[model samples]
Target: MSMTPPPGWYRDPSYPLVERWWDGTAWTDHRRQPEAPQLPLTQPESPGGGGSGRAKAVALSVAGVVLVASIVTGAVLLRRDDGSGDAAATTTETTTETTTATTAVSPSASDTPSPSASTSAPSPDDPSVVVDELNGITLPLLDGWVRPQYVAEHDIVMTTPGTYDCPGDPGLCRHGRVISRTVTANDEKSPKALAQQDIEDAANSSYDRDLIDNRPFKGITSHQEVKSGQVAVAGRAGYFVRWKVKTRVGPGGYVESLAFPSSVGSESLVIVRFAFDAGSDGPPLTDMDRITKGIRPVGDADTGGGVGSSIGPSK
Candidate 1:
């Protein structure tokens, strides 16, 4: 007759490192690391020394044999429970192992990443786009244009790469340039009035004198209105004024001031200034219209339009 062990935790037959719970006759899902087995302390030898020691030794040996027998009986019972042959036994073992692995905590899952952590806004320095965070707008970069490395008072500026000696000054100058900024100083609210007021200053700055008091275009001898009208810019109603200015030296240039209500913060008025050389080397006059149309809300998709040929660095 086989002896059945009482319900308790015992060292697992297959997994030596862990203990599994046995419920009188069968193993349970509960498992834990095996606790160290404790040995009873030996009593001090009495006057009958060797005999007492020998009896104690025999008792311990018998107890150890009983433990081994109980484990062997449990193993046999487990196999009989399966009823099938070696294949069923193997499947049982595999399932137990898989359950153990599934319950274990994985190191990687401890630190979960946030969904928004991987997202980021478009860079303002991107070669093909110019982001103006202040006024919440973006200007498309044309083939012959680039974001200026140094921007003075403008919120955003783009210009032809490289520069040439000014006709009337010792300073360097670009043939094509565009700048955008909010109109904070002026109290003018009407787009038409703002555009009309800014055009003369735009021409004077482009053809009269630069920041350093250098006259790149010598001086504006005269200027004639080439285009003036209400226009739509970046989905906003706006107005623009273009002028053909004659300079004291070189083939002069065209200047334009476009004023529009910004789509962002406070809906502030914004002014975009444009200056382009009049000769064949300058950016196309049509590019002015293209750029104005290309302006969009900061996050809008880019609308492609610009000069196809890149302007090389001045020799």
Candidate 2:
């Protein structure tokens, strides 16, 4: 006969990075990062006591085995005296108790999400809000904006629904877009320096060309600074740089790069990029300020109070 493993967390067969929980009968949705294995510590024997210690250990092992066997035999005899059906019921009850105790005492019990939490967890695709869990921030879903169905790796994006043909390429493009992601591959931590440096790239990507060198706005010919200054975002001091770029085809667009320390998770630097079509069809310029003001820490309710402010050009 086969025996089922007790309810516990075990290495996930599909995902090596995390462990999955088995609830006696089946795997649960619960998973967590694997913890480092701990090595057992051994107590060293005193000088000139190795032989005596070994002898005592052997004796103790033998005694433990004998004690266990005696207990097993007594249990079997008692069960035999009880009806077989009663014995089976008792075994089932004992197994259930063991499973509960094991789960309650698990080292990862504190880390596991409760059933309520699992059900109530926020989604990135929330219609009225974009939850960027990776950066621990939330952006408001203003009118005409929706979460992107597919975002680039490491990016959380919200864009205007529907698309229009690119001026220079056969690909489609949106009138407005915003992307949030943690800053990486750079050592600079100053918000102003990072924002200023990233704005050019942001403008280039939004107006000049895409990853495949597709010039969505037919390539930016020149850009004029619209705003570059210190700002407060999600209650954190940050910086932003915005520019209006002239393109060879279609109406040129406005782009901005904002940098700040994330409100959560080691306070890593985060960058938010914005691109909007530069015409009556695009989102209003004031909406940029409204969206910036609407940003808040994850789980924070929209108090409707403007928390972000542009303090003018950085010295």
**RMSD in Å for all candidates:** 33.9, 23.9
For 104-222, candidate 1 gives per-residue lDDT tens digits of 21113222222111112347466566777777777777889876532222233677765665677544467788877777767788888998877777777677754334455567777
lDDT of 2 by residue, 28-56 (tens): 43333444442222223445655333222
Off by over 4 Å in 1: 1-127, 150-156, 302-315
Q: Relative to the unseen true structure, what is the C-alpha lDDT of residue 286 in candidate 2, on a scale of 0 to 100?
A: 76
What TM-score would each prediction reach against the true structure?
A: 0.55, 0.57
lDDT of 1 at 94: 7
Q: Point out the worst 10-residue segment of candidate 2 by lDDT.
A: 91-100
Cα lDDT for residue 141, model 1?
76
Scored by lDDT, model 2 comes in at 0.56
